[model samples]
Target: MRIISLISACLISTAASAEYIRGSDYGFKLWEGAAYTDDESGQFSHCVVSAPYKSGDTLLISFSKDKTLIVGVANDDFNFDINKNIPVTIYVDRRQPIYATAIPVSSTMVTLSMPNFDQAMHYIQMGRTMKIDGRQFSGIYDLTGTKVALERTYSCAASYYDYASAPVQPDAPVQQEGLSKTALFQVATNMITSIDVSDAKYLSEAEIENLGFGAASVFWQSDDLGILAGTLTAHRPTGDLRATDSQDLALMSDFCEGDFASSSQKVSHVEGVSQRELRGICRLDDSETQIITTKTDIGEHTLYNIVFFLNTEKAGEVKRAEATGNIAIHAASYAIE
Candidate 1:
């Protein structure tokens, strides 16, 4: 059944003045599916699966804790007004047009509620491709792996609900204490004292931790140059955790989604810690992505990873060169205080 009448009601109920904070820390993965939590509450929020198409559009499907289903489409070229609602239509394998309203969550993304969750899932799973027609754009998405992804989403939502409804134990601890929030940040910042990022935007400790990274990690985004630079630390493995040549190449291939190459070389020792540098380059449809990563074994049970990523689509040649040079300089200058 088409969900024509539920659009307005859904929007009215979901519209809020409070800012929305999506948690990036994921609980588990089933294929390309992952369950995310609320950043503020740390409670399971939704399970989502996304796929990017060759046309540069991404299709997103999610099941929320409220038992509602959402379908979203995103493209970097889109610049919609946030919170604005626009009429849209969905077509599944020549099925009748399903009318809905799309609410722009960001400048580049819009989401629509699927009132008929079961029917929608059935249609999507049985269909080969789905198409969406918005007021300003239209896109076709392949439905590969959607069946498994949607099933995983349902399973994740159910598991979370069961856990939430379970009785609390009196002796159960609410939280655990670990390292200080700023411990990683302090050490990383001290290690790269020569690197200057006065103009870069720094991510908050909570934000970094929510990204499944170390709390207070030294991370910054350069919007102008389309680069991301970060240093993250994790517990050192008891066994060797170095990536093999083939594994490194596979990682680059997965990220690039096109032709890619990866090479590793030993770098000068830093404070008696042996350093290994990995370089990767990938050619995508409209952009080239480059990665420079330096790995070092720091303190006992601590491994530090310094990474730099640059996208050529948003940066010029000169800017890209400058960014890579800065990455090298930072890696070379790293030293524990």
Candidate 2:
């Protein structure tokens, strides 16, 4: 998955495109592509999900945040010849062939927009194979995950605007075995101003909502175990956060002592983006709870603070919860550059 993201970045740079990212929840995959201006400023962008062929080519369907749908295909190996009216036939599941005009993007890629995008999606979701122009040059690609992926893709895309208008409410809790606890809260989206759009191949509006400067908050609970884990974006602090010297450590220690008992502080190194960090572990509520907090400067004045609390009785859940939290924060943190 990481390799795919990296390659897509290179493809975008050589193609000279906007910052975007790809995310998946079900069988379909979403790509948030951007269009920038000559002043190195973003002009506009949108969310798109594409199906990849075995030959390393892809057929993409994009959903503009404006509520329009677009269809296109890309092959990094193609030596495409541009013509004003390029004819192409797209066949989904061997149904009646649909024809459209192909617009060449580079020597390697081309796209076409069709009016019947929903119909095209239907054919792909049925685990049918997609072929172009009788498949003389391209290989057949499976569309098994198209349905679920598309739903997740659009949901995340919509989340960008949804949060702007109002805080998004959490859906009903997901059922977990041997856990009987739940935590829920709404985080105001206005705290975040904009995303750090740099070197990213595709940036989904939804991703920007949760990244660097957006109002990103999380809530989860395990009912049976009474375990709650949450984190959120905070206003930038005025003082330097990268201070790991004696004076800074002393200040942090004092702060931790005021909030947690038997607290220990240290300068810890986390893999990925180089930055100053302070890690502290302490017992709260008379040692009944363990609190682990990390503060890292993702960018100048942009600090990401992660907090974790776990009950002593729920040791089994700690590993899974910690892993999920770390993976999410790490991904979001590194994307800033």
Candidate 3:
């Protein structure tokens, strides 16, 4: 069971007027006034750290198992809309300004994802202040105690995954069915570079030209979940491609950090065949993106993966539809035949 840490209940604040107190869990620390929600179930479900600005605005850093490490800016008096993408730059100490995009979480709050927590934390620890400059809003945040809070948040993530505490398990082979080894390895090196918009039933048709599948390993829409799919070949015989595929996907998924919230990775067996699946809910502006990745053994020394890019709002009901798998499966099955 997870226990949401409440180091000091009296430190909790119901309003922005409350004096910010110092709070810590694991090893990270943050202003008690900055934390907006505490699950209190012996598990750290949500860890939000914020700071007040001279303009009475609020800057926030939120950590959770299902969302990314996000730094948000909120102002009650501002007429800002989180539905649109707002470009911003972060200036730490005298270092070069790092470019980022802030998506709205509410009418007045906008957040940018911290893809590299270590780098951001390093800046916060040694820098005097962190400044955010957007098209219509700007704020300077104090870095005091930010290092401790970041450390604690990191600890919470490590613990949530049981990374330090759990023992490693040996790789296991996926259950097999009627298909021959040759037929099972379906992924090919030369993949389809361009797909017609109408052919992509699961993707947004409006983004057809702009969303062409480039050779890059990842793809994302400003308002949708990112999609990443590729094939990996083993130089030598690796008896269990399922384990290898799952591990690789895990590493890629963890790169976003907050993608682990409401995330799950497992192997499901059906009709004597096994498929490794990874699914997660990613927080977006006023909405969420759902990422689903599934892998299957197809050919000699090869494994095939199908990664999905879907929005919780639009594709919420159709994610499980057969159309999503029809393209990948029919193509693979035909190629092998």
Candidate 4:
């Protein structure tokens, strides 16, 4: 399954007709939705950047606390090309060259296809799959400009779970047999339970009365097992669904250089997808781990090592906006082999 998004930054030298990425703000009209198709790879994606999408819109660009950099154009701007053109510089460790490029993406997102290449590419995270050189992965790719700033791309693997068929029941219960208790939670247990997004309950009356124009997923216990219910929120862009699922598979990592710091302490984990650091941590045991990886985005970026914990538990109750902004890990009992 392609569980990541990619954002690319290409070196664009400004000629008379070429766009420059100086202090220019390629404003956008906050496109309600924007889509990007990668030229080198046949991967395509869409997103609804934060608010403020308009022409000449300005947004700050910087690397994660870890010193890892990504290209971004906020103000709800999108499309690698279409609107404003900013500039930027991409830097990598032990790398040489102040590669430069204008942020080809317009601050506003519209359907687009762009060409990108990096002679001096930075090695980010890489290992999120069973070891196989020919295998594909899904994650984000942040291409910082040699001088300008643009929004990031939510990149995914070229060959991902094909949803071309009608969307599979996100709540379908998948079963597998022949597993030991020790390794059950690793993959089957979690996914078996996660096949569904779960059910919801408006605890208080106010929640139900004021419930409108919002997206929600509620996981409750139908007996001892788990049942899920999801509601699409109103007033949100049609892009919300894309983002919600994209985030689950977003290839973009919040990369930086440094130790886990008191600064941005809350943001600890992130989904890494750069060729360099893609296959970061090794799995201790696979038969026991369903998706042998984690995604976090808080804390200092310069940590010598990053650790994410995944455990299993019963579906007592699971709520969004819960678990301290961290992904909620619920309990799932796998079918006995």
lDDT string, candidate 1, 187-242, tens digits:
34533343344446677766664443434356766676666666654333122335
- lDDT of each residue in 193-252, candidate 3, tens digit only: 211122222223233212322121222222322333333322112435454543444443
Error of 1 at 14 (Å): 9.5
Q: Mind giving the per-residue lDDT tens digits that candidate 2 earns over 210-314?
A: 332122334333444434433333222133444422322332233233354333243334545443433444554465444344444444223333333445664
Instruction: Name the top lDDT candidate.
Output: 1
Order of quality (lDDT): 1, 3, 2, 4
TM-score of each: 0.40, 0.40, 0.36, 0.24
Judge candidate 4 at residue 288 and give its lDDT: 14
Q: Is candidate 1 or candidate 3 better by lDDT?
A: 1
- Summarize candidate 4's per-residue lDDT along 186-301 as a digit string, tens digits: 43223334433343222232332122111121112222323322211111112122222332222112221222211111222233311011112213334111121222211111
Off by over 4 Å in 2: 1-16, 21-44, 134-138, 162-337
Which 10-residue window in model 4 sums to the lowest lDDT?
A: 297-306
Q: Which of candidates 2 and 4 reaches a greater lDDT?
A: 2
